[model samples]
Target: MRPGGSRLECCATDLRPRPPPPPSSSPQDPAIPSGPSLPPAPALRDLAGRLRRLPPSCGPVRLIGVDGHAGSGKSTFAGRLARALGGAPVLHLDDIASHEELFGWTGRLLAQVVEPLGRGETAHYRPYDWRTRRFGPPRALPPAPVILVEGVGAGRRALRPWLAALLWLELPAEQAWARGRDRDGEEQRAFWDGWVPAERRHFRDDPSRPHADLLVRPGHSVHEGYDVLPGPAGTAGQGPDSHRT
Candidate 1:
């Protein structure tokens, strides 16, 4: 809630690796544990191709929100998909959230990002400055053809109506928490203690997977499989009301 309280102005990756090689196209086989999946270049391109074709679900943009427990590999998966989409823009919840607000930052998001995007305009948001423990200057996000919103609550009800699709990082809560804690290291252990239940309450009340168009479980490698989740609200899935082509 820095200075940009709400009024919206306008608008608006990388490649890493795999725990093992990407699974066969079917992706149903257990992930081979021998090594990580280093996806072949062609497979990466295919992801880009398919994502490019998803019907535009947001006003004029195909906005896909990736939601899951923190450290559930949501950031990594979103980065890969963004690259596949030829550098599609990814908005991380970390940028919008602060230690103070945590899950309470939704109103700022709607004011700064969703409202403008709904009108097919670019939007701006003040990313939280973690080190300073406060928000910094405003950053602008253009309304691209495909905008990937990645974070824990990217698929919350307040924002779902404006999204084209919701994807759940299907890893279990404990596992995700472990990964997140490991990633942050001992430095952030205290912060994580409080974060765990805050996340639980957030999901318990406004879960997003029930409305996910895809449930993504990252294998030992980077390749991902998407399961079609049934739509929970009018906001998602392959029902008669599904927005997917």
Candidate 2:
């Protein structure tokens, strides 16, 4: 059945909800070393390689989820990873989320994407356009060898069964929100004020990372001040032979 609903509004922890990547690390991000020491570069490369080899967690296709706080870099990482995987398909949560629905798009996702993917059929969804605050045209997602679901609750309870790997982008709430606010700027401050707390409550009720198989934090610092650090914590919490980050 097709799902239909509207998202709820929220009051902020701070109505004044004022909100990177680097070599080594930065205050916004913490360096979490894996149990066994491996060179940073090789470790990440191995992760990508292993993901490629893992038997499809969902049917014959690997349904990897890159979940984390908003502005935690899920979208950016998912895009690059898709490129690495030779143009893999990525289903962005932003498409499902609307100005009113926000995180309430799960039902729409299940009805539109997950169920179809389970049948190895194409999934269709009308992505929500934020600027105009309306859903765009229906997008068809083919059953590829791998499909990425990246967003805040990509690993939520409702979608777990369909996932081959659940990856959490390890960025704290404060730091993550700060970046989000900075990126969106003061113009959207009102929207963000409501968003931060709503996000907090959403994570509180339906947490994703605790059960994640791996946690990715990728970036590095250059001679220029822009720090780019790409580090991931490998921890596939469950699955008999699943790996840990």
Candidate 3:
């Protein structure tokens, strides 16, 4: 609500390590640990290949939605994944959101970005400037083979049907919010105070996890890569409803 109403035009990695087998109880067999073992993470190349092969979700573009709580490393992870996909274009939701309409920019996105891309045309949007609290000149996003939409509510119900695959960062809200608050620091403390409740309310009413195709867990180190697991919504190959347009 900075200037435009609800219709405002605004706006991966892989590592695998095998643990040594547990000591054998008898000479015949090794005793497995009672604790569950996580499946090996897919290589980054492998994940990229899989994503590239998905059916186009928006016209000629495979619109990949990378959704998660703020400061959950969605941007960092999406950057890596975009590199893996050979420099896919990324559209940050931050560019679409204004201070006044934190989670209310859905309609603007659909009209300015999604609709044009859906019709195999270039999408132009004016990115929001948080500091100035105003929108800048229009920017263009061509329909690429793969385009990543990364932000907090990328997987909201309204946008899910158009996603080739929805990815959720598997980080708890408290920890994620803490990281966000710290990153924003004391200067933006008041903003964070308002943001936390708004984010909570948004998720409570329209949770994205239940509709995510994959849950991405970051590794401990930069080179360690990420662990990707199937989410409650569906697996990679199982397409969501495509007829919805």
Highest lDDT against the true fold, candidate: 3
How do the residues 164-226 of candidate 3 rate in per-residue lDDT, one tens digit apiece?
Answer: 888888888888888766655566677777888999999999999997767777654444555
Candidate number with the higher TM-score (2 or 3):
3
TM-score against native, each model: 0.74, 0.73, 0.79
Ten contiguous residues minimizing lDDT sum, candidate 2: 10-19
Choose 1 or 2, whichever is better by TM-score: 1
Which 10-residue span in candidate 3 carries the lowest summed lDDT?
2-11
Q: What is the lDDT of residue 32 in candidate 1?
A: 23
Off by over 4 Å in 1: 1-44, 221-245
Cα deviation at 117, candidate 3, in Å, is 0.4
Q: Whose TM-score is higher: candidate 1's or candidate 3's? A: 3
Q: What tens-digit string does per-residue lDDT give for candidate 2 at 1-245?
A: 00121111110000001113222111112222222232223333454565676666555677888788876767666655565566778887877877677789889998998888888888899977666767788899989887889777899888877776677766678878887677656666787788888888898999887766555543332111111222132322223332222
Judged by whole-model lDDT over C-alpha atoms, candidate 2 comes out at 0.61
Model 3: lDDT of residue 164: 81
State, as a TM-score between 0 and 1, how close model 2 is to the true structure: 0.73
